[model samples]
Structures are given as structure tokens and as C-alpha cells.
Target: MKTAINTAVKTRTLPLAIADFKQITKAGLAFSVVFSSIAGYLLGADQIDLTVLLLLSVGGYFMVGASNAFNQVIEKDLDALMKRTRKRPVPSGRMSVPTALTIASVFTVLGVVTLYVVNPKTAMFGAISIFMYVCMYTPLKTRTPLAVFVGAFPGAIPFMLGWVAATNDFGIEPGTLFMIQFFWQFPHFWAIGWMLDDDYKRAGFKMLPTDKKDTATIIQIIMYTFWMILASVFPVTGLTGTLTLSVPAAVIVFILGLGMLLFAFKLYNNRSNRSARQLMLASVSYITLMQIVYVVDKFL
Candidate 1:
């Protein structure tokens, strides 16, 4: 009977561990990082090595996973109060805090070491990104709305990390990648804030601009969306010099940006949950498609 009970418990807890892993690492977010890193690699490297590419992918995942795990550990208490997050492993007592911390530490160390093997500069930036995200952004989420801006710093680093991994140096090429992603986040996250305004409010998260759904926030989204569109097209214009998209590639990217902008405008005009949700979906599609276009353009 004892052995049977132990087996049952282990079976039940396995799913929780899986769920925890997903929540902590945010596989969706990691996918974006991976894709952007690939874009960086394409832009920076004249010839790609599969081995280096594999290392970069692994190192990127580890860095992002560690940041997410530490985020859960820090936000475990506040997570319980939020409707959208209450059932997470740390909040539900499905995973011990100490165990989570251990996992986070190990992932962080291993991730940095992996990147170091790839290139020291890549490893340094990876460590810095993780530090800013978990140590700074996670804590700032509860305290102020500026956390979003702060978080964008680390969020934008993956694309540049890819460049560094390829070229083993920082320059205008990586700078452009960083700027593009940095501008993209404002609208992306603001739409999320708009969609989950009520839930965030319940958890005392000041994500929305000044906690107001007024013209200011909407205008900010629109402005950032406009800037994102510009930044997305800038590389194609040959203004960035190091990375230039073909004319056909530029046209496709423009259309994608316009599609996302239309949704942003809808959210701004309506300020309804439905509009916000649509913008959120549009934003997701925009980023994914943009990455695809970048890769396709390279090959074509």
C-alpha cells in the first residue's frame, strides 16, 4: 500500500512539475528569443556553423528559463492574489520555494557557462540580461509602472545577443536589433495590460499607464506602435547599413506592420476588452511573421 501510494503521488506531481516548468520559463517568450537570435545570426554571420547555432539556442533557452524561474520565486506571494496567476506552482504549494530557487540558480549558472563557451561577450550580456530581468524588473512590477520600460532593456537583449554570438562583438548591427525590439515592447505589453487590466488591478500591479485607461495610455500605444513600424522598416531602408532587407522583403514586412497597426488603432479607438485582445493577438502574429520574413528574406 505504501509503495502504491508513493507511485500515485509521483504520477500526480509530475504534471505539476511540467506546468511549473512552463510557467517559469515561459516557452512562448523563449520562442521569440530564439527566433530573434536566429535573425541576428543571419545578419551578423556570413557563414553559419551548426554547432555554434546549437550552442546559441541552448544558451538562450537557459538564460530565459532562469530569468523566468527566478521571477516566479520572487512573485510567488503576489501571484496567489491574481486571478490569472493563482494556480501557478509556487502559489499553489505544488513546488517548494527552495526547490524553485535551486533550479533557478542552477539554470542561471549553467546558462552563463554555456554562453561563455560560445563567446565571453555573449555570456556577459546573457548574465546582464538575466540580472536586469529577475533582479530589477521582477521587483519593479509591483512598485511602479516604469518596470515595463526597465524590463524592455533585458527583453531587447536577445536579438543583440545573437549578433554578439555570431560576430563576437558589439556594433551598429546589434544596436539596430536592440532598438527594434525595445520599441516593439511598449505596444505589445500595453495591449496585454489593457486586456488584463482588471486582473492586474486585483493583484496591485501598476502595469497600465498611471493606472488610467485614458487618452494618454491609448496615445502612448499608438505612438509606440508607429515607432515599432518605423523601426521594423528602418533596416530595409539601408539606413542601418549593416542589415538591409530586399525590396520584396521590405514590402511584406510593411504589410505585416500595417496589419498590426490597424489592430493597435482599433484598441485605441474602442478601448474595449475585445479590441485589446485582438491587438494582443495581432501583436503576437506580427512578431512571429516578422521573424519568419527575416529568415525567408535571407534565404531568398
Candidate 2:
């Protein structure tokens, strides 16, 4: 009788569990990663192959989703410590470990298999991204401030992975895409760290390079934002064969960089979370617009 009841209960919870699973996966983040990958694909492809594009989207979403689900599972205890994450499915007991693990395993197989259909290189990088996110970045979050820097590697891969998917090669063109997103991660995450410093501390995650909102940390943000801006302009320099940008587009890209830098400057001058929040919003706009600019520039 007890076994039958448990099975009936699970049947009822299936839909709810799926809902919680979406939250666990952080669907918005997965979408952003997919969008970036699509931009990379469009920029690299001589002629857009809709089939490959669709496969990239499906595979990228599940791969990122699996990584995020496992991250919640690993950090379930720590997550319950902070208000920001206390209500996550794993932490709040809305979903059981077994259920979350099942989701992760399913996504792992589905994502890798779908990406494999695109190309081995795409599949390999997708799998590596999941491994690094769950195995490397997740653990380092509590131990070292440098985790942010290390996390940047996998964070930057999707943009380049798009190129690899379209071309099945890793070259200067893809490297350029990777570098832009790589440098972009620093200031973006540091700003987020600034806003969530207290919550992060409650969880023992030393996200910011420095524990405090000091001059040094702000300087690092500025320096990385500068580097990101420089990297964004690389294609327009006529150095990259596949990613060359027209002069007009280069000018527009520079302006977008300035827009992001403006907020970075505000953060530096104020040294407050309010400014950090603004910088965070600006960073999102900058990266998204920059990616759109790159794709648009290709045609003109």
C-alpha cells in the first residue's frame, strides 16, 4: 500500500517537478548562451544552415540546462543559506535529488547526442563546458576568488562554439569571438558580485576578486572592461579574415563599448552597489548589442 501511494504521489508531482526543473536550469541564462551561439554561427557561416542552427540551439540549451541543474544540486546546502537562492528547487525541497539527477542525466545524453549530430567538435566543447561548469567552477566558487576568472573559460566557449559548429574548425576567427566574450565576463560578473556580495558571503562564495568594494576591485573592473572593448574592435582591424567589420560598423561597435565603459566608470567613481547594478545592466546590453553588431557588420 505504501509503495503504491508513493508511486501515485510521484505521478501527481511530475508536472510540478518539471516546472521546478525549469527554474533549476535557469532558462533565461540558457537562452542568452544560445543567442550568443547563434550570433557566432551566423557570423561564421557562408550560408546559414537552418538545420545546424536548430541543432545548435537545442543542444546548447540542454547542455547549459544540465550544468545549471547540477550546480543547484551541488550547492543545495549552501544555497539554502542565502535568501537569493533559498527557494531553488533543490534547496527548498520542491524537487528531490533523485529527480534533479534524472533531469541532469537526460539533458546530458540529449544535449551531447544532438550536438554530436552537428559535429564532434561542437559536441566535445558542449560536454567540456558542462564538465567545467559543474566540476570546476561550482567547487571553486567557495574556495577561491579566482573562480570567476577560471569560469570565464567555459563561459566564453559558446560564442566560439557557434563558429566551430558552422565551420568545424577552431581558428583566429573563433578565437576572436572567444576573446571578446572572455574579457566581457570579468566586468559583468564582478558587477554582479558587487550587487550580491552579502548574499554571496552568506553562502561562502567569494565571487569578487576582492571581498570588499575597494579601489583595487573597481580598477580591475575598469581594466577588464577596457580589454573587452579592445577585443570587440579586433575584427574591424582587418586582421581576421572571417570576421572583418566595415568601418561604419566598427564605429558603432566602439560607441557601444563606450556605453558599457560609461557605466563601468560610474561604478568606479561611486563604489556602490547601485552603480554596480547599473553597470550590470549596461554590460548585458553591451554584449548583446555587440553580438548583433558583429552579425550585422558581416553583411555590410
Candidate 3:
């Protein structure tokens, strides 16, 4: 009976632990960040080394996970007040702050060391990304609406970090990649901010441009979508070094951009949560598909 009870306890505790870890890490978002890094790596690498690829994947995830863990630790109280975030590990009481902090510290060390193995520059940028996310962006979220703009810096780093990891150099190529993602975040996150405005307000988060779901905010979203679309085609302009986009790929990218623009317009027209949600999904699809198109165009 003792052995059976132990077995059952272990079985129950294992999955719960895993689930808590996932919650603390924001695993899905981390994976998306990793995908951007990988896409940048594929574009910059003349010849792929599986070893470096593996290191980037592992290290990149560690860095992002650490940022999220630290953010959760810092925002646990605020998170508890927000319905959307109330169930997170720390907020929900499934995990302790000390445990989350320890995990974050461990991840930070592991992430930096792993990235350092790739190159010193890679490690440096990775560390910077973590600092910006946790120290700057997290604190700024509750204080200013411009937090989105500040957050964009670290958010843009993964794409360029992968390029630096591959080339061990920073230049127009990585800068262009960085710009593309930098512009993309405004529309993407603003749509999310719009959808969660109420939840965000509950946590004292200044997410939207004007702190309300008004015409000015939607107009800004539309404006940023245009900028993001323009940035997406910067490679085709012949100024981005090796990160060139073919004419056909550019057309496809433009079409994808138009689709996102359409969603932005729908949000403007209706200004409902459903429209915001659709715009958010379209923005995600736009970025992911554009990255895939960029990689495929480079290889093909």
C-alpha cells in the first residue's frame, strides 16, 4: 500500500510540475521567439552547423524563459488581479517566488554560457535581451504606454541575435532583420493590448496607446501595420546586403501584408473585441508566414 501510494503521488506530481514549469516559462511564446531566431540563423548562415543550431535553440529558449520567469516574479501580485494571468504559476500559488527566481537565475547562467559557446557577441546580445525584458520592459509596463516601444527592443533582438550567432558580425543584414521585427511588434502587441484592455487595466498595465479603445488607438495600430508592411519589403530594396528578397517573394509578402492590413481595417470599422482578436491572429500569421517565405526564398 505504501509503494502504491508513492507511485500515485509521483504520477500526479510529475505532470503538475511540468505544467507549472510551462506556465512560468510561457512556453508557447518562447517557442515563437525561438522560431524567429532559427529563421534568422537560416538566412545568415552560409553553411549550417547542427551543433551551433542546437546551442542557439537551447540557449535562446533559456534566455526567454528566464525573462518570463523573472517577469512573473516581479508581477505576481498584479498578475493575480488580472483574469487572463490569474492562473499563472506564481499568481495561482502553484509555484513560489523563490523557486521562480532560482529557476530564472539558473536559466540566465545556462543561457549566457550556451550562447557564449556559440560566440562572445551572441552571449552579450542574449544577456542584453534578458536585461531589457526583465529590468526595463517589465517595470515600465505598469508605468507607461510607451512600454510597448521599449519592449520592442528586446523583442527584436532574437532575429538579429541569430544572425550574429551565425555570422558573428552585426551589420546592415542583421539591422534590417531587426527593423522588420521591431516594426512588426507594434501592430501585433497593440492588437493584443486592445483585446485585453480590460484585463490589462485591472493590473494597472498601460498597454494601449491612449489607455482606451478609441479611434486614436486604432488609427495608430493601422499606421504601425503600414510601417511593418514597409519594413517587410526592405530586403527587396537592394540595400539589406545578403538578405535579399526575390520579386515573387516580395509580391507574396506584400499580399500577406495586405491581408494583415485588411484585418486592421476591420478592427477600425468594428472596434469590437472580436475584430481585435482577428487582427491579433492575422498579425501572428503574417509574421510567421513572412519568415517562412523569407527563408524559403533564400534557399530556393
Candidate 4:
């Protein structure tokens, strides 16, 4: 009986622990962030160094995980108020604040150390991304809609951090990468905010550009998306440092941008939750495919 009870207890606890880990670290989001960073690394690398790639993948995930864990700790109460976030580890009572903090602290140290091994610049940017995300963007979310703008700074760092990891330098190449991601966040997040405005309002998060699902907000989303596409193709003009895009690759990227733009226009026309969700999905596809185009163009 004792052995059977222990077995059942372990079985129950194991899945809960895994759930807690995934919630605190936001595994899917972290993986996407790491994917962009790796794409940047590949773009900048002259020769693929598996060791550096391995280190970058691990370090990037750790850094994003640490940021997310800390953000959860800070917003535990607010998270509980939102239907979407209420089931998260901290808010749902699956994990303790202290435990989450400990995990974040450890991840931060490991991430920084691992990135530092790649280069000082990479580690420095990684640290800045964490600090800005936790100390600045997290707190500003409830206070102002400008929080998205502030968050963009840290959100854009991953792609550029990879380039710095490869070249150990900050230049136009990484700058262009940073700008591309920076502009991409507005439309991507605004689409999410449009879809979840109610949930966001329940938590008092000022996510929308105009603080309402209005024409102004949709206009801003369209505007930023336009700028994001322009930034993506700027490299094709051979103006952005070592980064260059082939004409065919540029055409493919432009077509991808158009697809996203059409979705944005759909949101503007109907202003329905479904349209917003479609725009959100399109935005994700746009960024991912654009990054792939950039990296693949370089090798071919």
C-alpha cells in the first residue's frame, strides 16, 4: 500500500511539475525567440560553429525563460485577474513565488555566463534585455500604452544578439536586424491586443495604441506593419552593412509582407475578433518566413 501510494503521488506530481516549468518559462515563446536568434547567428557566421550554435541556443532560451519567470513573479496578482493568464503556475498556486524567483535567478546567471563565453557584447545585450524586460517593460504595462514601445527594445535584442555573438561587434548588420524586429512587434502585439482587449482590460494592461479597439489602433498597426516590411527589404538595397538580399528573395519576402498586410486590411474592414486573430497569426508567419528568407538568401 505504501509503495502504491508513493507511485501515485509521484505520477501526480511529475506532470504538475512539468506544467509549472512550462508555464513559468513559457517554453513555446522561448523557443521562438531562440529561433530568431539562431537565424541571426547563421546570417552572421562565416562558418557554422556547432559549439557556438549550441551555446547560443541554450543561452538564448535560458535568458528568455528567466525574463518570463521574473515577469510572472511580478505580475502574479494581475495574472490571476485575467482569464487567459489566471491558469499560469504562480497565479494558479502550482508554484511559489520564491521558487519561481529561484528558477529565474539561476537561469539568469547561467544565461549570462554562457553568453559571455560567446562574447562580452552578446552577454551584455542579453543582460540588458532581461533588465529592460523585467524592470522597465513589465512595470510600465499597467501604467501606459507606451509599454509596447519600451518592450520592443528588449524584444528586438535576440535577433541582433546573435549577430553580435558571431561577429563580436555592433554594426549596421545587427542594427538592421534590430530595427526589423523592433518594428515587427507593434503589429504582431497589437493584433493580439485587439483580440484580447477584454482580457487585457481585466488586468488593467494598457496594450493598445489608443487604449481602445478603434480605427486609430488599427491604423497604427497597419502603419507599423508597413514600416516593418520596408525595414526587412532595406537590406536588398545594399545599404545595410554586410546584409544583402537577392532580388528573388526580396520578391518572396515582399509577397509574404503583402499577405500579412492583407490580413491587417481585413481587420480594418470588419474589426472583428476573428480578423484580429487572423492578423495575429499572419504576423507570426510573416516574421518567421521573413527571417528564413534572410538567412537562406545569404547561403544561396
> Scored by CA lDDT, what does every candidate get?
0.85, 0.92, 0.94, 0.95
RMSD of candidates 1 onward, in order: 1.5, 3.1, 0.8, 0.6
What is the TM-score of each predicted model, taking all chains together?
0.95, 0.94, 0.99, 0.99
Quick one: how many clashes does candidate 2 have?
Answer: 0
Q: Model 3: clashing residue pairs?
A: none
**Model 2 ranges with Cα > 4 A deviation:** 1-18
Clashes of each: 0, 0, 0, 0
> After aligning candidate 4 to the native by TM-score, how far in Å is the CA of 207 from where it should be?
0.3
| Rank by TM-score (best first) | 4, 3, 1, 2
Per residue, candidate 1 scores C-alpha lDDT tens digits across 47-89 of: 8988888889988988998898899889888889888888887
lDDT of model 1 at residue 154?
96
Better-scoring candidate (TM-score), 2 or 4 = 4
How much lDDT does candidate 3 score?
A: 0.94
Error of 4 at 42 (Å): 0.4
Residue-level lDDT tens digits of model 3 in 152-230: 9999999888899999999999998899899889989999999999999999999998988999999999898898889
Error of 3 at 62 (Å): 0.3
Residue 140 shift from truth in candidate 4, angstroms: 0.6
